[model samples]
Target: MLLGGLLGGALDLLYAFGFAASRGVAPTRLLQTIASGLQGQAAYEGGTASAALGLFSHFAMSLAWAAGFALLASRVGWLRQRPAFAGPLYGIVVFLAMRCVVLPLSAYPHPVGFPPLSTSLDLLSHMFLFGLPIALLVARALRR
Candidate 1:
């Protein structure tokens, strides 16, 4: 779980940072945006403190996701059996949950919309970088 969380969190952050950079967004601002989920518009005012919180919140969420998958995979044999398929599917689920449910419930200030290009990239990153790593790691752990 620890490994999955660290790896997935790092990968996800990297992707987010890279994507933000391509759009002329600074990494700190990106982190602040994440912090906005919890702190709302105040996150932008809090600077590094809020950015740190965002980073911590991101990793904590990654760990939670990893732990959740690990727990489910432990009980469901097939999840451990087919990491590739299950991982991507789980990514989609995570994407939906975050975009649909989690964001709406949080202090996020922006309206949620599935704009095609960004949405596609986000989904792919979650699948290939986030969920895939957690699923693969969990499957490997179970084999031991």
Candidate 2:
């Protein structure tokens, strides 16, 4: 679980950095800005403690998602048989569920500017960034 969480969080952060780089944004600065924005603060403090906490939080959330799928796969015969595909499928379903149900219900943070493009990029990022790593990990684990 620790390994999977670390791997997933690393993948997510790397993708986020790449995405920021593509937009000519410094990854660290972008993250700080986002963090400050979420906190409704004027400036970011750049605290290592906060950063570590954030990473752990992200990792735990990812691990929870993966574990949930593992539990479901254990019970569902079809999912157990198609372990390779199950992860990606679970990722897609989770993404859609979050977008359609969770996000809409929660007053959580979301992108503000670049409406359609931002949302599209977000969706694409989640699909590949989050989905791909989990998929690969699950596939590899099943094969072992």
For model 1, state the Cα shift of residue 6 in Å.
Answer: 1.1
Q: What is the C-alpha RMSD of each candidate to the true structure, in Å?
A: 0.6, 3.8
Global lDDT scores for all candidate models: 0.93, 0.59
Model 1 lDDT, residue 55, Cα: 98
lDDT of 2 by residue, 20-102 (tens): 79889775555554344334333246555444444554566678776766566556766656655655566577667766775
lDDT leader: 1
| Candidate topping TM-score | 1
**What lDDT would candidate 1 get against the real structure?**
0.93
Lowest-sum lDDT 10-residue window in model 1: 84-93
Give candidate 1 regions above 4 Å deviation.
none
